[model samples]
Target: METLITDIKIALGDNDDFFIKRDYLIEEEVVFLGLNTLLDITKTKTTLQKQTESLILKGKTTQLLFNLIGDVFENDTKRAISSILEGKLIIFIENTKQFIIYEPISKSINRSIEIPTNENVIQGPLNSFTEDIDTNIGLLRKQLISKQLIVHTTSTGMVQKTNVSLLYLNDKVDQKLVDNIKSLIEKNNDLEITDLQGLSKMLEFSSWDTISKFNTTELPFHASQFLKRGRVILFVNQLPFALILPNLIWDMFIVENDRNFPFPIMIAIRFLRIIGILVALIAPGLYVALVAVNPEVLQIELALSVAQSREGVPYPALVEVIIMLIVLELIIEASVRLPKSVGQTITMVGGIILGQAVVEAKLVSNLLIIILAATTIANSTLVGTQSTTSIRLFKYINIILSSLYGVLGLVTGIVLICSYFASLTTFGKSYLYLNIERKDNSG
Candidate 1:
């Protein structure tokens, strides 16, 4: 016991927050080890003192004394040390050479469940996941309310040992899919995962892929929906979002809240989102192609009007599109990184100033300004930020191709994107597969 204490002290170093409280229990020297910030010192000490008094009055044996501690108590030295580090109170009985680790009485510091700010839905549960994992699990359980909703927890990360939970409907999910997810997690057990991105990469999901292989959401209702669809959900400690695995292409177009609306309305909204994606992806390219390479395709009056619009622009259509795209991207990045109030002001002011200045300087046509603005607005309609980012990035491909071969190049770029998406898979499940018809579709 003395050697274990010494090792723990050495490992923790001289941090001022680390505390050791010595006392007497059942005529044996008792010691409590924990972090001051994490443990409720007064409550722990009082509880220990009261239990010690009770044992003495009853003349209980050491075996009885051990029974009073929680089930988390262990005889293993390494595990005891780990528990102490993880904010658990470690109680050592010097004479018996025994140690019991249990939960501390720390104040609740987690934020209360609130409406999701990022993934807003018009008619669904407003509650979002919090930083506390147990709270998050409780939310999931409340929504699922089924015995088949299985949750398995394991610790990862070398030094910090962050907890990760795997959730799925046992009867609904495929056995092979569960095995595959567990296998990947076990292989990456040594990784120091600090966030969702780290875990995604550890699972061998490519970060550079244009389409995200995981659908992340903060709403427990959405997570429940994913589980019902036979998808695996991963929840990391301290992260406010859960990751839905084997992210399919259809997941990008559908929103969980859509189910609350009329069927036709839901279908119409999804169709509009798809249209938004297409316009965002191909609008700039088509504009450049028609003006620079395929002007003959337009009617005489429309072609004449386009020519008049571009009369004062000194640069080629491609250069002009690229310049505006860069500016738009810069504004977007800056707005996202800034405070919301400041971001709105900056975006509005920056767009007006840059658009006016560039047009006055005859650098880009007025018609191209409208096209880029519309394209930027359309890009915002994608389901997730990652998906929106992918769409925005792939637009450059269409822009480049159209510069080379006009409408034909734009069409080719679209086909290439579709082919790439169709060829992709996550955990052996095809990305392009649609699971709308079946409840337990594994593809």
Candidate 2:
């Protein structure tokens, strides 16, 4: 018993919350050990100790313990330590050198379900996925409500075990896709997955890849909708969002809840997202190309007006664009990281006052400010934030190319982007990927 207790202490070295309590079960000295922070020690452990004492009188120590607890790990100190950390009550019978490990009352560790702060709800379910994977799966199952919704749970991580679940509709999901995803995970079992980026690495995606291989949504409604459409949704423990794999080009322009509107309205909404993406990608580069390289393309009167707006700007068109773009990027990043109430104030001050100040000070042209504001607003229209990253980064390439070769370079950059999307693969599913119908006997 002393050896086991010392082993546990050694395993969790110097953790102040770890504790061991000595008590007697009717004159038989017993030891209870666990993390005090995680275990319910005040009332629940006391009641449990009383029950163990009563059970001991009725039968032999080992026999009664095996009967009462039904989970006894003998001499496996590693397993014992893991159990203790997981909030299980550990009782050791000192004289016999025997130990029984069973679950105790664990303090409430998970937060309640709250509305998604990331994904805005249009006309769908309000509650979103929480940090608890089981609760998230439960939320999904409540909406899916079908036996065909298969949840395959697996444990991953190198030193510690983390539970991950893959949810897909058995009747609609492709068998090949499921097998491929499962095989990729099983083959990389040794790879530690602490976050989504780690999982991306485990999947062997290039770090330099511009577009994310998956799309994320905090909304359970969107998750369920994706599952119904024959897509796999990955849920990592403690991650409060669902990752929809092989995120396609169309996902950026499409919102599942847009179906709530009439057919014409839905089409119009998707069209607007497409238009927004185009404006975001083209505006900054077009500003540079027109003013610096292709001023002759504009009408005579328009060219004169553009020249007038840029008159006081000391820097060339490219430099002026770069300066304003950097300021805009800083403002955008600050607004996201700050607290919501503070973020709004920062946005107003940085966006309105700072923008007007720069134009008046002639540090950047007024036309450049209008172009950047439009780019920032248009960037937000993309469906997923991860999807927006590609545009945000690639737009710089467009700006550089446009500044050099005018409209020709911008066209080349756009073509390269199209080719990049075309070359992406999500478990062998490319930009043109779609779900294969499940065979009737498959499920």
Candidate 3:
């Protein structure tokens, strides 16, 4: 009991200097009360002492001679510890180990609220989840009041003690999937509790060299949608994002805005997104392969134009393409690191001025310029940064392979990438078989 008091004092320190008073109720009966705030000591005297004794004596086999303090120790260890640090006073009755927890929350609620940047909406709730897990959970719980809306939370990060919640509808969700997620989190391996990326890498079935085959989302609407579809959602405290499982390649092409738009418009946009991904992934590679080795496929006028554009350039087609690609990537990197307004300005100036200058200098062909620009624009159409990054990386592999074996190498790279995707499985479920209908013998 004294150790607990010491811990409380240490947690409070100079910020909350609660006075510890020891007094006698009757002869041989003593009480110790730790008071930081005045309101707790003033209201309800006899009940406070009774509540404290009951709490400390809870589940105890031996009779405690000391009168325990009430209000503080009623909760479990985690909640009790959390309350103490948050400015709840712990008072103990003398000759007993019972204690009471006083509620005097030091939290301030004056901050102005704003729309979340990551989870912007066209026609939904403007509010987004913040760093507070209770607030986030409250938002979700208000939306889903059913008993089926299960919120199982666990403390992660040994030192940080971060709260991680697994939310799902008990009746609608698969029990096996829930158990799998629970078990995975329970392991609490040192490697499993790092940054979000580390957690993802541990949970994801992608190989050491494989690109990310999962989708991450920040919008609660998306998460709620997935929950209704019998999917599981994993949310980490202090992280603005949540991870969805069993995501397919097509998932990346989807946007929350799709639900607001008309079905036909959404379908058209989805088709365009699919096309964008393909073009972004392979356009530059195809251009490099065709120009370097397969000129026979080009029309006479196109061939002449490319040849004219390449004239007086010292580097080979591959070297020139590689150089331009690297430069474009550097500009993109710089844009990401710069401030938002500055980044936008740099993109405009770099996209136009530098690109046009390089084309006029005969350092790169005009056709290549168009292809690269198209690829960049296509990549930008992807909703998630992960997908965009994956596209960028595959583009490199495609370029290199295309340069080596021409069109055949590009085809081979595609096959290899597809094979890798085929090999991936999350929680023992195949990642790429989302649309495949399976036979349900029992049904």
Clashes of 3: 16
Clashes of each: 0, 0, 16
Candidate 2 lDDT, tens digit per residue, 348-405?
7868998888889988888888899899889889999888867888788889999998
Model 2 steric clash pairs: none
- Per-residue C-alpha lDDT of model 1 across residues 1-443, encoded as one tens digit per residue: 78778877887658898887788666667888888777777887777678767776788776676666554343577887788777788888785567877666875567999999789879989999998898999999999999999998989878778889999888788778889879888899989889757887678888777788888898999999989888988989998998898788777789889999999999999998999999999999999899999999999999999999899898999999998999999999998898987888988998899999998888898899999999998988878887898899999999999999999999999999989988899877898877722354466
The numbered model that scores best in lDDT is 1
Output the lDDT of residue 93, model 3.
Answer: 43
Decreasing TM-score order of the candidates? 1, 2, 3
Q: Which stretches of candidate 3 lie over 4 Å from their true place?
A: 1-3, 7-95, 109-113, 189-194, 201-209, 435-443
After superposition, the stretches of candidate 1 with alpha carbons farther than 4 Å from their true spots are 47-62, 72-75, 436-443
Which candidate leads the pack in TM-score?
Answer: 1
Candidate 1: 10-residue stretch with minimal lDDT: 434-443
Arranged by lDDT with the best first, the candidates are 1, 2, 3
lDDT of each: 0.85, 0.83, 0.68
What overall lDDT, based on C-alpha atoms, would model 1 receive against the true structure? 0.85
Estimated TM-score per prediction?
0.94, 0.90, 0.79
